[model samples]
Target: MSEAATLTRTAQKTEHFDVLIVGAGIAGVGGAYHMAKERPGSSFVVLDVQETFGGTWATHKYPGIRSDSDLYTFGYSFKPWVGAPIATAEEILRYMGEVIDDNDLARHIRYKHKITKASWSSQDNLWTLEAVRTDTGEELRFTTNFLWMCQGYFRHSKGYTPEWPGMADFKGKIVHPQTWPQDLDYKGKKVVVIGSGATAATLVPNIADDCAHVTLLQRSPTYFIPGRNANELADTLRELKIDETWIHEIVRRKIVHDGAAFARRAQEEPEAVTAELLAGVRAFLGDDFDVEKHFTPRYRPWRQRIAFIPGGDLFMGIASGKASVVTDEIDRFTEKGIALKSGETLEADIIVTATGFDLAVLGDIDFSIDGKTLDFGKTVTYRGMMFTGVPNMVWVFGYFRASWTLRADMVAEFVLRLLKHMDEKHVKKVEVALREQDDNMPLLPWIDPENFNPGYLMRGMHLLPKSGDKPEWRHSQDYLAEKEAFPLIDLDDKAFVYK
Candidate 1:
């Protein structure tokens, strides 16, 4: 029962699974769940870069960190969250753990085994993966007949380091929300929050009550509006004795379609909705606050992730003198405080960099496809899940604008379908045709952000999938439409070639 012996036994067995899943986040775990259900007795392992499961849930331990999306859509469907409409990170993480436990996936989960590189072998039609363990100098090399690249793309390991002028000089316990220090106390101390994204918004009100002075720095104005995003509707349906899965389906559809409808409106009449959104922020600020300077954003509505007052705590915090909002660019950092472009210096004891997250590509893991070094940037994403010509690989790059679970669920089903198809046809490898792909479309910012750096809110706009001629090729921000498009097992037969 020794550690090395256990590993040696595992290594000697070469425990061949039908699929090898990477990144034990929502997507990968969810996919594994579906695959387990559909194809019983099929061996698989869900691996993670971190020491624990729940990728962002486990790592992002920032104070006042909570989900932006309502828990109904955000929470897993199999498990019910009876806690509250809005959930804290701990609650969500607990929910995820429950999912793994309920499904008995804990044994299949291996953590801290970072997959550095994955290369597909054409001859064997399998993937050879290079994985390294952080704690011990242990190295693992493995191969699977099929590779499910539920490969996630968030820079979790490192914080987004903005090249702020003289930032290194004034550094007074500078912290990023992704890697918050629990020991640091902000009670009665001057705290400056620098950013306008959801993370900053969520933290401002939560921290304002404890801090002496809190200033929200905005280099560029963010689209701020007040709205309701609750799981109460889901709860009510459950009370009515409606089928829970049916309720999940309906709610998921509602959110997805609502996103699509809003996107359509933005495409049709950009200025009207944009002005209306700006007006909401203006209304929240009152007549005294400068709405034009602090609320107006450079891009139109839907171009950037809009900040919403889910609990109205942000505006309440500002009104209660607990928070202050500043719209100015950071000129540089002085020893005592930060200097803004308006020749103003704000004193601060602690600075929180809430700038935003960079769209990191799959742990920034290196890839070699058939001995060719894979340039992920040059490679166009196929259905936002599979990349063109990446044989035997199916990744889960879900929705950014809509619920994260929506596409993840569908991608799970898609993987199941493809796997079933392979088994039915007695095929080991299958390659989806690039010709079947619709490349003549705009790259959505909602998923791709290698280029979007300055504005964190707008980074995802380029990441959204292109509107294809057909639903299969299209990435619908709309939920119900996606349901019709991506059924459990209705992929285009001609699009895939069996080996």
Candidate 2:
């Protein structure tokens, strides 16, 4: 057969759906549930690169892997989280399993199907997706009327690790938390973890007791909220025999209200918020410890995310003498360990780089529209979910300060509403475009570095889509403001182009 004949045969086997969702993580699973419940007649399928559900939970297997955000908000609003506010990865996966089972979403999900390319055809009013099954290496194709991108913002294949001099000369085994080896043993070994972020905080404590001695090396300090993981409102509600669903909703509201207030206070009175956060850490590490040097951050509270240390476990590990903290800049790696710029060399048998992750722009999938390669950086975001010139597609980029699921749930509702509106109008295509007023609006980077500049986001800001001055044109990342504004969004607004 000719090459064209083979291509024609493959195209003939392509499956089609009303909607196609990427990533089977929390956001993807929630998207599926909403489509099933609200748009029961619409045919949709979810594709994930991982072999199972729980995107991050399934990918990360490092020790002490758990949620930094409280589960009440991280979990789907439709489902009640019955466990502790901070849950282990295993527990989270189990909860996700229950959701899949309860909703009968298993049949709709295709695991190990990694989407490699997405092309939008204006003539056909459809999206053609090419995927490969990771397990069997089988090629697959699908077409859909709408595309729902739930793949997270970070690269899951590997974590980021900076190249240090003498790394090849060092005899010790170097590991990254994202790809933890299952058979590697750490018992009685001297371990050093690099980075001051949440990953380092979680790993040092969990491995302290087993290691001969563990040290946390950092270039700068970060803010943390050390507190008990228990939620008092949920406990009281349970004692009073309240329904689990009611408890979930009530506690979720309280937390959201408190979070909004906290965010406001952080902006209005940054000094006070910083002092209070430092005080929380001081209480955990005790007055004698060098909290100023080790715990005090240079930036204001909530500038970057303040990780919650459940039960103050990370601090407890430091206080117990099993672990120690070293705040210094690394000059380079030595034969034995890392050499600090201060002329001090710390020895370690094993080193773990908990630096961070690389941000993934639109699942790193090759995307093209109308035979032209789409440059996302050239488009302005529409409420951070949709892009200008992008039709019949929605991407779920969640909150940084609040639980990610909160925005996921909101976006699900918005997408459903848009779909229904399109049906009513008998339109086959819908896209966002700049209105006359937006022509002179100033375009800026996706996010302001001063507001929330994490390493991953800062490094990848150039690759992200731009934002406009108008509220409708920017992502905002403010859940409180979006909560009120999203519901009032007029589908027939001037910016919306329908055909």
Candidate 3:
């Protein structure tokens, strides 16, 4: 072959690593940090489809975008969050960037590498990944001993928007918050926002003053905790001259403890919890406003996530008459706006669909084991991290009720321990399988609908892996229980097979 041909072939050779982390988002970055810190000198690469880090924060550019959870818990344990409890997207990006730069993790990451396929070869005992450079359209190949899937659970290309009749006939521009257009002007425009979730809550308050008239339209209301963004404990600690790191740990523990208690109260004494939540809304909306009709949810609190609105901003917007709420199903879209089932028409110059996300199963990548396509739905989840019949792979599916990074940090620690155990035993492969005692364990859906049934999960539940009756086989979303249980798990359990 010609020297030029030889050079080209060499350039396209498959790169190999001890581990390949699939994403540069919060979970992915956390995993990478743990590997670098605990397993120093390990060969690992972090690949992301986006041009930079901060997965959700990087891609979402909608105005007033901020975290629904408090930063003390949402932030990593190793890092101290000195900002407000609720932080904006820019603040989050800056925090993540500091983690990368401070840890010198930038060298281990490759941007714009979108994995298209992941094939596990039991004979070779490695995962072969095929990816395409989204920016350049160049095919790339890599082989890794372990695959850490942390690409997140939503389709970033588009947000979920239910189709309504006469959408094509509408004269006004319809936009989804996931892909907000930068050039689109909304100044003095009469706007209508659909959906009552966190996105709507955040967007309505931010855009209320800019729009001529804004209306928040929802089919059913969702629960929210409207309060000041400050954390009193952390503020007190700061005033006492306590270190930021110490403050972070102290405040995180307090929040987690309080959150667990609140969750229990919601489940055990839902009526009281419901009354307390509505009262908070009444405080902002006053007795004259219809809080029961506008803010009361049909389901109990914590069935779906209860978003936290900093300083009750959304309620303030409504009370000021800058924004209004309409509780009714959409009959269809009208030329000028939306037609409601209550025989009312909301006129608008622009419409924003604040609907939920389209859940992505295993990053939506085509996965196969030994030349056979893998159906995640058929396999059982092992503690919601590892799956039966999948070798040398661990996915970071974080907690829904708590800060996502809490579980991400826990999973990272578990991964480090597992890797060390494998090394000490001189094993090349490891996978979780059901023990004999688990043979008759009933298989159930990923999550029980009664416990938590969000729209995205309900829509994509079929695509997720099944869980068993035992705690070893299910994802117990209870953070407090898992925090105590994870560290005590025996590495030599019969469920783990090594070779």
lDDT of 2 by residue, 1-499 (tens): 9999998999787999999999999999999999999999999999999989999999899999999999999999999999999999999999999999999999999999989999999999999999999989999999999999999999999999999988998889999999999887999999999999889999999999999999999999999999999999999999999999999999999999999899889989999998898888888788999999998888887888888999999999999999999999999898899999999999999999999998999999999999889899898999999999888999999998999999999999999999999999999899999999888999999988888999999999988989988899988777878999999999999989999
Best by lDDT: 3
Question: Best-fitting candidate, measured by TM-score?
Answer: 2
| Pairwise lDDT winner, candidates 1 and 2 | 2
TM-scores of the candidates are: 0.88, 0.98, 0.98
Worst 10 residues of 1 by lDDT: 445-454
What is the lDDT of every predicted structure here?
Answer: 0.73, 0.94, 0.94
Model 1: per-residue Cα lDDT over 1-499, one tens digit each = 9999998886774446668888788777887788678877788887787888777878788777777766666666665556565678888888888888888888888888888888888887878887878778577777887777665666787667588888888857788988888898999988898888888888899888889989999887766667654656677887899976788667765655666787778768989988887666655667787777776777667666665577577876887788988998889988888999999999999999987776665556788889998765544455566655667887676665666877787777878888887888888888665453444644443333331234533554444323334444444456656667667434446656678
Off by over 4 Å in 2: none
lDDT of 3 by residue, 341-373 (tens): 999999999999999999999988999999999
Global CA lDDT of candidate 1, please? 0.73
Whichever of 2 and 3 has more lDDT, that candidate is 3
Which segments of model 1 are wrong by more than 4 Å?
A: 1-15, 81-83, 228-232, 235-246, 275-284, 436-478, 488-492
